[model samples]
Target: MSAFVDTLRAEWTKFRTIRGWVIGTVAIVGVIVAFGLMPGMQGSCGKNGPGSECSLPVGPGGEEVTDTFTFLHQALTGDGEVIARVAGMTGIATGEDPDKPNHTVEPWAKAGLIIRAATDQGSSYAAVMVTGGHGVRMQYDYTHDVAGSPDGVTAAVPRWLRLTRAGDTVTAAESVDGDRWTTVGTARLRGLPPTVEVGLFATSPQHSEELHTGLMSGAMGGPTQVTGTFDHLAARDGWTGAAWHPDVIGHADGPANGAPGAEGPPAPASGVEQVGDAMRLTGSGDIAPAVSGSGGLGVSITQTLVGTFVGLILAVVVGTVFVTAEYRRGLVRTTFAASPGRLRVLAAKATVVGGVMFVTGLAAAAATVVFGQRVLRGNGVYVHSAPAGTEVRVVVGTAVLLAVAAILGLGLGALLRRGVTAVTTAVLVIVLPYLLAMTVLTGDAARWLLRVSPAAAFALQQASPEYPQVANLYTPADGYFPLAPWAGFAVLTAWAAVALAAAAVTQRRRDA
Candidate 1:
């Protein structure tokens, strides 16, 4: 017992004398925290950007309009080759979706509403009509010709949308709801019209004059509920609107809430009148801004706690070096002479080092949890809600694993004796597989590699309701096997067991 006590004292003194280990541990923690805080880091909690905005109806026919903050645009495709275009001042010109390039459609081929209103009273424009200066617009030229009677009166209710071309004529009919359809007045003009602009019109007779427009050159813009349905042009037309389905354009058809569809109302009216122009059509006030939820304080605390636990486990390198340093200095022989029984010396050193790592891990984890929670609260990510007792169990579990990992290092150090060899072997056993997975394997293979690495032990930090991307990967969402927190720990513990057993056998047989 006395010899064991002497061994413990010696181990404590040597560990305290080392400074490099402390620096390494601090560096790792600092790097991880800094990475998490980077502006667009996956877990970073911040306002992504401006929320979607939209202009309301101006008047009955909805000709005059107001400019909205909504960034809406158009996508058209179909026919021979794929094309992309945006609806704007000149007309539908080739445009690209910055966020989803695959959503691009061919110009004048098929028409699409890049943005729609959740309510009704919006207009739908066909592709291939990009000329006329007024009303819902599209651009097209008639190679063939036809003649229609000059007289077609629009319904007094301001419902019929009329197109005037000689031979080829296209009409879009809208009823009170999408389930029914009615023909507005047909265009009975004289000669064939060349490429023309076609667009829906919203007029605000009570408030303003200038038209408002929506620009869809960027991300998913415009109001969500406005849906645009299209009809086919002809048997052998350039754009049938069927080849490139609405689904291909990334739009789902639904009702509109009076917000301008596609490119919005005419450009903002000049000056002070604009305020009234925008406010003339009162909104339902039902629309809610998109809100990103912040995690609870408890979750942040949990992450920090776990991080600190892992940090302390890594701290065991100091103990390994401390023990081996004495041998390198030729003082271990004196230690053995003083201690006598080898087992007593090993037990004393293991107890002191293991106890220090365990206690330090617990404290560090607690401090990390507090600090991390505070930081996450400021950003908006929250922790999962669990009973107070469960939270305590989690905290204790994490710290215990870290404590065990540190002790495993001590056993390994005893068996190897040489500082560099043992430390390198320990680190390689835990780290090399993960690095190899980066290039040598992919998909399922990589997942298995992760399970075997020290990093897998961190799975204890995960909870249900994870981010969509993460949940898809780590859970049964896609038929992949999920290793629950404890299961993951068991895998890590098994590795530690193999290491510890090897160490014990070596220590028992090898000379001091």
Candidate 2:
């Protein structure tokens, strides 16, 4: 143990004595800071809400979302059911003007039944809807979504949608012939209100650039106003045959989504109501990346850790050189002569390189999340933060990712016995896969890549996640990692561990 400590000290001395590597490691903090701040500058925000309110989200554990849609709701006291039969769910999806021939309906465009909390902006709710393509689905809270039916929604045919609430549990089912119903799924809400709003919802996202701000900021689309025709609408118990109240929610979905006749809402956009039969509702917002049944956007932390790539590249170079430089300078003999146990030498190097990388990454990631959010706010790009604990995990988890990756790079260098080749291979294994997963791959393929590649660990840095239970487009392009954070990081750690084992074996078997 003393000898191992001595070797670690020696490795540390070597790292500190080198100017280029030290500088590069130090520069990681600057890279993270700069990159993290860039997104704030690029963001275009400050859209006015209802009554001259242009508010930025400030909370923990909630999504920085714009969930606008139309609802024809009636109040329900205690556990009850909201059921409706759909005649058709159709809407225009056009990149050009609505009048253009290019417009058409999207397969995912939805019209359905919803049960929600009173607050329109951010609420805990469950929905069963007919999609433009995916048939029928059950969405609850925000992020949890499940496929209810495989049959596609059509105008000629009508499908019955039912949402039965029993205390905290909501059961969703769909019927082709109204009597024979197939259970979609059940949602368990923790703090469901005895009296809640039950309604039929029809919404179509612009599905275009009108509301799209950026990939990280989430779906900012206009309400394409899907007029879903419903003839049979019934509520169970709490029996008041009151005419449904028509409300358009998620007004903050975007500017283009709400500006009518050129007169802006001027305040933060709120729900627009037009109540009548056929209950026409025009809104485009989503309940995805779900809200906790007890509401509040804990702290809106932007998930973008801009400096991850640059910092990893630096870690790779420094880590590779930590081992390869010894071979280049013919110093392996001296290192072996001093330590005798080559594994000790390798362990020392791994400790030094991995430790340095962890510290550097932790600092960079922490600063980026902490100070970067402030910078974003100063630039009028309020970054919605997550909970303090979650933020801490992200900041720390980033460091862990870098440390493991550095160790992987060091092992590869020792195994391959060359800096350039090792660095290239490390980057290919660690960084390239992340880039490809994020940019080039399809959602499914990206998921597979992240699942298998060493870079799958990048999921650890994702502060925002798309829940499968939610109705949002859960695509790789929208920052959704196929794996959970720690689980994904574990995969990378496995790769690193294997690489280190191989390096240890090769070091024992071969000459310097």
Candidate 2, residue 238: lDDT: 54
lDDT of 1 by residue, 181-267 (tens): 444333322332233222222211111111113311111222211111222212223422232211111112221112222222222
- Highest lDDT scorer: 2
User: What's the lDDT of the predicted structure labeled candidate 2?
Assistant: 0.70
Superposed Cα deviation of residue 320, candidate 2 (Å): 1.3
Q: Give lDDT per model, in order.
A: 0.38, 0.70
List runs of model 2 lying over 4 Å from the truth: 38-40, 47-66, 76-82, 94-104, 117-119, 165-170, 186-194, 206-223, 252-283, 290-304, 436-447, 469-478
Q: What TM-score quantifies how close candidate 1 is to the native fold?
A: 0.44
RMSD from true fold, candidate 1: 19.0
Please give the clash total of every predicted structure, in order: 63, 43
Error of 2 at 10 (Å): 2.2
Top TM-score prediction, candidate number: 2
lDDT of 1 at 20: 72
C-alpha lDDT of candidate 1 relative to the true structure:
0.38
What lDDT tens digits, residue by residue, belong to model 2 across residues 1-512? 99999999998999999999899898877887788877444233443444433342211236444455667788777767877887765466323354554445555567788888675566778899887677899987655678977776566778899999888899999998889989999988778878788888866543422122333322333334455666567897653436667676645433444322112222222233333544444445444443211011212353457678788888888888899989989999999999999999999999999899899998888888887776665554435546677788888988998899999999999999888899999989899887776656554666799899988787777666554333344444444567888988999889989999999999999998
